[model samples]
Target: MEWIKLIGILIILVGFIFKFDTIAVVIIAAFTTALVSGISITEFFTLLGEAFVKNRIVTIFLLTLPMIGISERFGLRQQAVILIEKMKGLTTGRFITLYALIRQLAGLFGIRLSAQPQFVRPIVNPMAQAAANARYGKISEADEEIIKAKSAANENFANFFAQNTFAASAGVLLISGTLTSLGYEVQATSIVLVALIIAGISFVLIAIDNFLFDLKMDRKYGKKSSKGGQKS
Candidate 1:
């Protein structure tokens, strides 16, 4: 019986690895495991119901999908582009870097900052493109796409790396709890201070990376202009 349950779990893992529908895999695994364990269908369903009740927050967020979809249908991208175009003297890298900083700051307060359809697809991507065009006179299609991807990645990295700095952050709390459970006296503030030091280092590294990339692009553009002038 235990072996059957283990086999059911293995099947679910395999299904996931093969990119099968997650819901179907979960349902199949649950049914198979219940059958092997001699659990009646009604009891299995009751257990599932209890699990769902325990995770009601997840269901509430899933319910918000339709409202978010409706809002996206109403000129969200166009509005973002227009707003970005109004800002002068912004470069793609600078614009994205500023957003990254804002995202990190917001994470400290446990605000959920989404990238797709909210930050990246709607705002940051368009803003980065507009900034690129403003700086380079005319950005190519490929460069515009690159800017969008970079902006999204920047937001992800910034938010993930900075959250560790907050004393009450989920990661810090999780670590502190684990240590306490293991009979070790750990301070959340000490963990947070260490996380802050690491976050600061990460910020500096990201900034330096952006700066170097911008410098390289400027040099490449300067070379191209010089060549064009020589030809003229």
Candidate 2:
């Protein structure tokens, strides 16, 4: 029945509204569509296998997860703190702002290596704290949490707004593919181009906010000497 064609969408709406398991909802949606379209069971599985092989890139992040975990366990984060402590004139806000810029730039090329779970919390957040200590001499727990929270927000805003600019990015590809299949005939480049304004504005606004916060910190602690302190 033509009415059955709407079942996939209905399942999605209800599944999300009820907060059901997302993966199971997607599987059910696909089955509902196949069944309504009179697809034989054998053909449905064959098509599913072909689709999986075509887009196995979705599993690439899982391959890198274990190595990231191992690196953290072996003192990779401690090394980051030591390196950051050695850099003179790098304040808490300056370090976080620079990180956001680097992450945003990498997003243009579809690189997301500095994400929060694997990199920022373990590595970047600690580095920011080291820089703060170098500048302020000592910071309270509350102030440290403030810096870390800002660092996390910086990474999230920069990465979330900028990554869509990469035409070949997985998110962009998925969106464009969905639209194309629905007969919209849109190009990924157009989407990326439109997103550029949003990304650029976000980078500039967040950078300014960060540097201004550093000015506030400078007043809280005595301003640094012109020598930028001894290197290492």
Task: Judging by TM-score against the true structure, name the best candidate.
Answer: 1
Off by over 4 Å in 2: 1-69, 174-185, 224-232
lDDT of 1 by residue, 76-133 (tens): 6677767776776555677777887887777666677555645677668877776655
lDDT at position 227, candidate 1: 26
Write down the lDDT of every candidate, Cα atoms only.
0.73, 0.86
Clashes of 2: 0
Candidate 1 TM-score, true structure as reference:
0.80
Q: Note the residue pairs that clash in candidate 1.
A: none
**Clashing residue pair totals per candidate (backbone < 3 A):** 0, 0
Task: Indicate the residue-level lDDT of 180 in model 2.
Answer: 98
